[model samples]
Target: MRSKQEYMEKAEELIYKTYNRFPVVFDHGDGVFLYDTDGKEYLDFAAGIAVMGLGYHDKEFDDALKSQVEKLLHTSNLFYNVPAVEAGELILKASDMDKVFFTNSGTEAIEGALKIARRYAYNKDKSHDHEIIAMNHSFHGRSLGALSVTGNDHYQEPFKPLIPGIRFAEYNDLDSVKALMNDRTCAVIMETIQGEGGIYPATEEFLKGVRKLCDEHDALLILDEIQCGMGRTGTMFAWQKYGVKPDVMTAAKALGNGVPIGAFLAHGKAATAMSPGDHGTTYGGNPFVTAAAAKVLELFEKRKIVDHVKEVGDYLWEQTEALSQKYKIITAHRGLGLIQGLELSVPAAPLVKDALLNERLVIISAGANVIRFVPPLIISREHVDAMLIKLETVLKKHS
Candidate 1:
C-alpha cells in the first residue's frame, strides 16, 4: 500500500480543491475512533459533520447494507421497493409528518422543499410573486437552489444572480422575521437549531412566534432540520421540543447513519402540493440507500437512541461547561444534546489543527470562533471523559 503522503499527493492532483482538509488520510473507523493510513488512532468528535450518529463499523448497519447489496441496489423510483416503503413509513412516523419525498442528499432535500413551497404558492395563485424568508448565518446546502437561501454572505457572494425572491432575516429575532413577512411571502425557512452559524438553538418564544406569524400570513413554515434532526437533539426531531409543527421540514445527516440519503417531509396542505410529475429524482430512495436508512431507524427503535442521546448529551455538556469555567479562553458554550459548540476568545482553527495532529482528536470549527462537537449518539461517558482529557491538554498548551 502507498504511504499517506503518496495518497494525499495523488488526491491533490486529481480531486477538486473544494475543502481545506486535514493532512492525515483516514483508513478506517470503529466506534468513536478513526485510524489514519499510518495506523494512528484518533477519537472522532465531528462524526462526519453530524452524519455518523451510530459511529463506525456498526454490525447491524453493516449487515443490513450487505444484505441489500446482495438483493437489489437500484431499480429507479418508477417502481416500488420494500426498503423504500419501509423507510418512508419510518421517517413519517418519527417526524410526525404526513408525507415524505426522499432525495439523495441534504441539499437535494432542501431543493425539493423549496420547489414544493414555490409550487404550492403558484398553484394557489399564479399571478402573485412568491417570496421565501430564510435566516441569516444559516446554512442549507451548496447547490444553487439551496445556496440561494443560505444566509452567509461569504458563501453566497461568489455565486451571484442566485435564485430570486429569497430574503434573509436575523435568526432568533422574531421582529426581524415579522418585519420581512408580507402578503407575497409564501414560506419561511430556518434551522430548528442553527448549525454552521454556530450551535445556536432557537428560543422557545422565537419558534412559537414564527409559527404564529406563518399561520397568520397563510405561509408555510419550513424548518431545515438537516443538521439537528434524527435524534441529534435528544428527540426524533428537534422541533418536537419547541411544541411547534412545521408545514415542511428537511432531514438528512444522521437519518442514514452515514449512508447518503435525505428527505423533505410535508403535512396537511403542504403535503398535497406536489402531485405526480411535479418533481422526481433518478436514483433517489433507491433500495440500497433506503435499506440502510430503514436499518438505522430500526436500530434507533431497539436501542432507544433518543434517550441515550439525552443522557449522554447532558454529561457532555456538563464536562464542556466545566472546561469553560476552568479556561478563560473558552468564552461561552451552547447546545442541546450531541450537537454543541464552544465559543473561544481566540480563533479556533489552530486549536482544532493542534488537537488533530498532536492530541489525535478529531474536531471541527464553526463560524471561526466556535469549536463544534458532534459526536456519535452511542458514545459513553468514558468516551466523553477521554475526549475532555485530550481537549484540556490542548487548551493548557495554548494558554
Candidate 2:
C-alpha cells in the first residue's frame, strides 16, 4: 500500500483513462524539484504544465494562502469580497485592460473571452451568425466552447458539430487570416505563443498585421495566454513585447502560481458587452483563489519576475542553442523567454520517459516531436545547468 506501484494501480482503476500519464507518483515538491513516493528527486522542468511559476512551497505564497484560509474562503460572486476586487484591480492594471472576469480555470477563461466577442457583436448588430477565426495548430482548452475554436483536426474530429462559425487560419500567416476573415467575423482568437503545437512564437509583423485586420473588421482580437502569459515571455503578457494589445486576453496557468485561477481581461466594446445575465460564476472569484492570484501578482512585481525572465530566458535559449549544436537529433529550437521547445528528429516520448526514470529530470513533449521546457520561473542558473546535464544524459542515450 505504501509503494508507488500500488498507488498508481489504484488510481488507474479509479480514475478516467483520458490521460496517458507518466508512471511517476509525485508525493511532494520544493523549490524546483519534485520527490516521488519512493523519494526519487526530479529536477522539474515542466513546472506542473507551467503553473508553478514561483516554484513549489514558496513561503510567501503558501503563507498568504494560509492567512486567507483562516480569514475567508468562499463568499461567492453573489456578494463582494476584498480579494476578488483587489485581484481584479491588479489584473486590470497589469494588462492595462478596462475590465476583467475571473474563472475557475483557463478553459473557462477562453469560454468567457469567446462570449465577450460574440456578445459585443450581438449588441451592435443583433446577429447570431458571428464567426470566430482561430489559428491552425493552436491549443485553447478542453471545454466545448474552447474546443470549438481550437484549430486542430485530431482534437476536434471526435467532437464534431462544434460551435458552427469557427474558422481556422495559418499561424503567423497574415494572408491565411485575411483569406478567412470577413465582416461576420466577431473575433480572431489565437495563442499569444502557441505552446502545445510545438512552441512557436508569433512574429512581430504577423501579430501587428492581425491587430490591423481586427481593427479593420471591427473584430475583437482574443489572445489566449493561458500558457504563455504571467511573465513567461519576459513581459507580464506576451503581446506586451510587440506593443500589440488584445481586445480580450485570456489568462491562467501561472496567474495564481498553482492556485487554480483564470481570467479574461477586456477593454472598450468587449468590456461593455457582458451584462449580469451574459456571464456568471459561483466559485470563480471566491476569496481564496483571488487572494492567491493577488498575492501571486504582488509577488511577481516585488520579485521583478519579468526582468528575471528576460535575463534567464536569454541564458536558457543560449544553452538550448548549444545543445542543439551538439546534438544533431535536434532539428530546431523555437519559443521565447522561459517557454522554449526543441524539435527533435526522433520521437520525443521515449527520451522524455528516459529523462524521468533514468535521469530523474522532468520535461514534457508537444506535437509529437518537440521537447517542451517550462521550468519554474524561480529557477536559477544552477538549476538550468543541472537540468542540462541530466537532459544531456538522456539526449546522449537517445541520439
Candidate 3:
C-alpha cells in the first residue's frame, strides 16, 4: 500500500467531498486505541462517532462476524433469516417495543421512522397534512426526510424544497414544542440526549411534558437514539433515564458493534402503523448484520455493559468537572455518562486538531465551541485518564 498521505490524496480524487475528514489514515484498532498507517497509536475518544461500543478488535465481536460470514452473508429481505428473527426478538426485548424494521444506516432508519409517523396519522385522519416537531440544533440524518426534521439551518439551507410540515422547537423548552404543536402534529421527534446538538440531555420535566402533549394530540413520540443508545449514556437508551418511553425510537451506531445496522422500533398505536408493503429494504435484517447485532445484544446482557458505563461514567463526570475548575478555557460541561462535552471558551476544532496531531488523541467537536467526548462504551478510568492527559496538554497550549 502507498503512504497515508498518498491514500488520502487518492480518496480526495475519487470520492465526492462530503466530509472534511481528519488527516490521519487509521490502519487498525485494538481495545480503546487506534493505530495510524504509520504505527502511531492514538487514544480513541470519538469511538467512530459512538459506534464502536465494544471497542476495536473485540475478539467476540470479530468471531461473531466471521461465523456469520462463513454461514451466510445476505439473502435479501425477501426471505426471513434466522439471525434476523433472533436479532429482531432481542431488539424488541431490549427496546420494549412491539415491532422493528432494520435499515443499513441511521439515516435510513430515520426515514423509516418518519414514514411510520406519517402513515399512522394518515391512517387515523386520511390526510397527509401532518407536521413533525423537531428541536433546534438537532442533527438526525442528511437524507431528505431526515434532514427535514433536523434543525440545523446550515445543513438544510442548500437542500431547499425539503419535505414540508416540519417545524423546529427548542431542545429543552416544552413551551416551544407546544407552540408549534397542534391537532395537525403527527409526531414529535428528538434525540433523547441531543448528541450532535452539543450533548444536551433533555430535562425530565420537559420530556414528560412532551409525552403528555403527544398523548393529548394522539401524536407519536419519536426519539432518535442513533448516537446516544446502546449504552453510550450509561443506560441502554438515554430516554430510559427519564422513564418517558417513546412510541417510536430509532437506533443504530453500536447496535451491530461496527457492522452497519440500524433499526426503528415502534410500540403501542405506532407499532402496527406500517403494513407489509409499506416499507422495505434490500439488505436490511440480512443474515450477516443481524447475526452481528444478535451477538452484540447477547454480549450486552452477558457482560452488564450498562452498569459498567454508569461506574466509569460517574468517574469521568467527576474528573472532567474537576478539570473544568482547573482550566479557564473550559467554560462549562454538559451531558451525562460517556456522551459528554466541555464548553470551551476557544474554538473546539483547532484544539481537536492539536490533540490529534500533537498528543495523538482523538476527539470531536459538537456545535461550534464544545469539545465532544463520545468514547467507546467499554472504556475504563485508565482510558479516561489517558484522554485527560492528552487533552490537557493540547488545551494548555491553546490557553
RMSD to the hidden true structure, all candidates: 0.8, 0.8, 0.8
lDDT of 2 by residue, 370-389 (tens): 99999999888888899999
Candidates sorted by lDDT, best first = 1, 2, 3
TM-scores for all candidates?
Answer: 0.99, 0.99, 0.99
Cα-based lDDT at residue 207, candidate 1: 97
**Candidate 1, 229-344: lDDT as tens digits:** 98998998999988899999999999888899999999999999988999999989999999999999999989999999999999999999999999999998999999999999
The TM-score of candidate 2 is 0.99
lDDT of 3 by residue, 250-287 (tens): 99999987899999999999998898899999999899
TM-score of 1: 0.99
Off by over 4 Å in 2: none
Global CA lDDT of candidate 3, please?
Answer: 0.92
lDDT (C-alpha) at residue 30 in model 2: 97
